[model samples]
Target chain A: MSQSDYDYLCDFLKERSGLALAPDKEYLVDNRLLPVARRHGRKTVAELIQMLKGPDSGHLKVEVTEAMMNNESYFFRDRVPFDRLGDTVLPDLLRTRALRKKIRIWCAAASTGQEPYSIAMQLDQRAELGGWRVEIAATDISGDAIERAKAGLYSQFEVQRGLPIQMLMQHFEEVAGQWRIVERLRNRVDFQTINLLTDFSRLGQFDVVFLRNVLIYFDRDTKLDVLARVRESLAPDGYLLLGAAETMVGLGDLFKMVPETRALYRPNVAPKKPELALVPGGARVA
Target chain B: MKRCLIIDDSSVIRKVARRIFEGFGFTISEAADGRQALDACVTEMPEAILLDWNMPVMDGYEFLRALRAMPGGDRPKVVFCTTENDLAHIARAMHAGADEYIMKPFDKEIVEAKLQEVGLI
Candidate 1:
């Protein structure tokens, strides 16, 4: 691919999906976009780029974006995050939102649906979450990804990556070499195709937003822009989670980093003092 | 025979580590979590421990801290075998008193070599 062609493709993608493809990513673009070109019956990536620049290339852009965005995902990606979410974060959210009687969660960039499904599984395990009105909205930029997430089918290798065998047995049924996530877990999550760079007001507000592992691809400006949008969608007392390596530092003042957990961020909510009172006789209240 | 305890939440990982130790003539004990591993460390008093970083009840870092707090002659040499391969994770593990750090999907030879270096074999 020529430098100009690469630049054209990058600019197109940046405008459409907010993915700022660097110059050095030519090889990656060639490898990933070639199949997209072939799928659209184009002879070369340059031709595909030309088509993308043309007035009537809406369908082609969608295909290219979908191709670029579909990522490898399993029942659980990193076990530690899920553990922290289940043990610490979810419980805190439940307690904090007790009076509200409802909770909204959004899994941003929910590739193949594993992350939201895993959360749903964890919530189901607690039994108490069932009492609350919980809505899980999972979105990915790729329509293909959203479709796959909806299917809830996973291969053996994919299932084994992070999911424990007990969870596998409990929540999935084996069909040949693949495992299908049970209907109960599938029903809990609402999956849609949503680009983070674009306006997400349609998603409404979320008490917890998981935008993990998807920000590394963007440049600083895009990260900041996406973070702002995410901040807007987040409820006042909401939590925003990123990948282990990603952080909100220097990028935005919309979130405060939660201590100890590397990627956890909280919206600008006033720190509530612990409920404590002194007894009339000078004893402390528990 | 040298007694070694393998502390990990993953059954497959423990099974693999058990096979590796069994090949080296060490008797193996197992614990599913950090709390169980601490209890087993006192009761069984294994010579060495192959610990995983993440687990339920308690994590390896907490287990290591408790093991260090125990009276002398009971604390076992520990090697962290986990999927956390980042340099920061390695530094944290070493700082927490892990004798060696081994990443998961570990080669059997490397496991044996680390065990030999630590005088566990």
Candidate 2:
């Protein structure tokens, strides 16, 4: 592909999806878009780009953008975030949401559903959550990924990655040669196709938002924009988990890190003043 | 170094496992069947055992049971490796004290991930 075509594709993806592909990623564009080109009977990626620029090419644009999305994810990925959910987040929510008896979690960029399923299994196993209504709203930028996540089917290789045997036995049933998430567990997660660059206010407020490992791919401006939007979607006490390598430094004070945890943050709430308490001997303690 | 015993009747599987485990910095040992694996455990218990199902003389399930019955057998994390994908086989292995199981035709990534799941790596 020529420089002009590559630049056009980059601009197109950036404008639509907030995916800022670098100049060095021309080869990556060619690699990801080649299958799309072949599927549409176009000889080369350049020709596919030409068709993208033409009139009445909306579906082709969707296909091309979906193909370019990075959907790499696995069960209980990185482990620590899930551990924090069980040890810290859930317990806190159980107390804070006791009156409501309802909790909502959003896994922004939940690729192929592993993260949400992991969370569902964690919630299901907790007998304490009995009679409480829990909803995991999992969304990804790619419709193809959302469909696969909805099916809850996984290959042998996919199931093996970071999934414990006990959880596997409890939550998944062997289907033909592959494994599938049990329907009850699968039903807990509501999957949707959502682009971060678009309006997601309709997703409503979430108690815990997992936008992990997705921001590193975007440019600086897009990162700030996405974080700002995510901040709006989060509840006051809601937790936000990012990739281990991602941070909120210079992205604004929309979030503050939870001490001693990796990539775990909570919406920035001002510290409350300590109230004075009367002591037995008439001494006041603050 | 972390120790791992690779038990399989097939020399090919053993060799592949050795290369993969060695890459993960494991001191590797080999066994042909369940009986051999039990004997090796008695001699020197490894931190991890990668046992194949349907081996000659003794299968993985038998070895797991026998190993768990031994004095220091419960110390090692046992992972059953096999072509059996059915829930029955998996349930049997887990019932016999196997920490995890992986299907056949696995690669280094699968082995590494399974080992990680069992806290072996």
Candidate 3:
């Protein structure tokens, strides 16, 4: 891709998804947009760039963005956070929010629905949550991902990734060399296409949000902007889970890191001066 | 039989490691992320830990630090099983108290040999 074409693509992506593409990311843009180009009958990446520049290519831009956003995901990804959620966090939240009698969980950027479905399965397994009104809302930037999430079909490779055998047998049915998440578990989660950069007011408030592993693509300003909006949609004392490498330090004062669990964050209801700790690799540990 | 914990984000790697260790008559426990591995280490007390470098919740580097800091001599010998083969990566793994390093796409015999060399078998 030419420098000007790359710059135009970056600008388009930034305006749509709040994702800033650096000059070094040309290879990534080319690799991701190839299929989109082919689908549009364009012979080369250059042709696709020209198509994107034309007035009729607005839909193609959305298609390219969606294709880039479809990330790899599988059931029960990164078991510890789920274990923590099941063992310590969920129990605590249940007890603390007893008066509300309802719990709202949102999985933002829930690619392929693994994270939210896993959460739903965990809640279903817990006999104590029987009486509570649980609403699980899962959203992804790509409509394709949301559709797949709704289908609840997974391949052997995906099933073997992180799913335990017991849970697999219990919550899913084998279908022609694939596993389909059972209707009961699938029904608990509502999947929709929602771009985090866009308005989230329609989604309403959430008690717990899983926004893991998606922030790495954004620049510092976009990260801050996204988190601020998340904070607005979050309930007081709501929990936010981020990827392990991601931190709220140097980003903004919207949240505080929960001790011991590097991935867990809680909204900063009361203003406290930010304290800096030097974690290994010079990454800030809040 | 000795107990082994395989911690990697990739199911393919985990399955391969499980089969390799099971072939050597070792009981295998698996964790897909670093935090789960730490919990399994505490609960199961495996004789050795086979760790991967990159993961989402907690990477292998942080897991190594946490494992080394655990109380008592019960800390198991760790062998770094990762795709990272660069000298800097090796140096970092060693600095984090890794006893041995095994590169990815490992054959069964190579992994068995590494295990035996570390006296895991």
Candidate 4:
């Protein structure tokens, strides 16, 4: 709660999660970390900060960071982006990847699993994707988030947010008064604990990347670094979708914003000449 | 193809919803309010009904109770669609023999997902 304590908390969060917390956000620190601090038997947040400064605060640090990191998610949180993903992005990717018969999607900061599962549900609906191999790699910085994402269970309140009742009935089963996503959907995504501040190239290339809504916490430089690293994993012809409020403009030049669209982007590569399609009569069509 | 009756006062919402269901190859019908929806149902019972909560002639709750009492009404799967998502309303709708529920401002995926949920598609 003191100036130095606030400084330590802010610096540590920025260092670990790239979240630039303002000095005046003591109330946020109090609200988020107080319960976490109490669990460690610390009398006050100051005591928790003191313990966090200790060399042997590995578990305590994980607890603190996980507590601070928001893990809110639901099936299809935002409708427009998913509609775009289903309507345009996947159709284009399916055509491009037809030769390979394989598609890889990475959902960065896949809190709890709804985003990735939402993607899986969309893919499942695509009759065009029959016999193709699809891999959705879902990752978050919090181990707790990854575990919960893996579990595929949601409370009534969690499912209430933007989740269709049909999805709840078809894809989920009531288990002990909570909804559990069916095994078929639960198996579609591979969950991992990934810290975006570090390298993520080892996760391999993705035909489509969803980094929605997680960028607001980062400072300008961190956003650039993160986008650059994300670019390393995105296929040259692949697409990246950001949150409605988040934009690639002035953040980095690894991508160019698509016009008249919400947040769809393609990699910033040299423009290729248009390939005309021939009509049945052999006339070239633009 | 299985038929689906979309009950909502808004023409735009009905059109938007019709496209989502028709994608699954279902025959689609629309009604402006609960009264017209009953008339549509009396002629031919649809395999599924996407009922909206608020309307001018009759609201969804009253229609649902009336429909369940009608001859052969229980055969069709009914999904209550509404913007009022409070737990009390949800409980009330479910209590009135509504099989499922979807919120307003839905698109293709949400519609298809609900249909799939009820095993209608």
Per lDDT, the best of the predicted structures is 2
lDDT of 1 by residue, A93-161 (tens): 888988877889999989988899888888878877767988999999888888989999986446655
Better model by lDDT, 2 or 3?
2
lDDT of 1 by residue, B20-91 (tens): 989998899999999998888777688889999999999988888888888753357788888775546767
Off-target runs (Cα >4 Å) in candidate 1 are A269-286, B1-121
Q: Model 2, A1-286: lDDT tens per residue?
A: 9999988988888777877788898778878999999999998999999999999999998999889989889999998899999998999999999999899999999989999999999898999999999999999989999999999999999998888888999999989889999999998999999888777889999999999998987776677667767877999999999987888876767688999998999987753323332222221222
Candidate 3 C-alpha error for residue A171, in Å: 0.6
Residue A24, model 1: Cα distance from true site in angstroms: 0.7
i-RMS of candidate 4: 5.9
The candidate 4 chain B region of ten consecutive residues with least summed lDDT is: B103-112
Assess chain B of each prediction and give its TM-score. 0.94, 0.97, 0.94, 0.96
**Candidate 3 displacement at residue A47 in angstroms:** 0.8
Candidate 3, which segments miss by more than 4 Å at Cα? A271-286, B1-121
lDDT string, candidate 2, B1-121, tens digits: 8899999999999999999999999999999998888889989999999989998898888889899999988899988889988889999999999999988889998898898887777
True lDDT of residue B22, candidate 1 = 90
Off by over 4 Å in 4: A270-286, B1-121
Pick the winner on TM-score between candidates 1 and 4. 4
How well is each residue in A1-286 modelled by candidate 3, as lDDT tens digits?
6788888777777767767777897778778888888998987778888987788876887798886674798666666678668766788788888887888999998999899988988888888887899999999888888999999998755654556444665688767756799998899998999888667768999889888888887766667667777887888778888866777778767898878886888888864434433222222233
Place model 3 in a CAPRI quality band: incorrect
User: Lowest-lDDT window of 10 residues in candidate 3 chain B?
Assistant: B109-118
Write candidate 4's Cα lDDT for A31-79 as tens digits.
9998988888877899999999999999988889888888877677667
- State the displacement of the C-alpha of residue A73, model 4, in Å, after optimal TM-score superposition: 1.4
Candidate 4 collision pairs: A166-B114
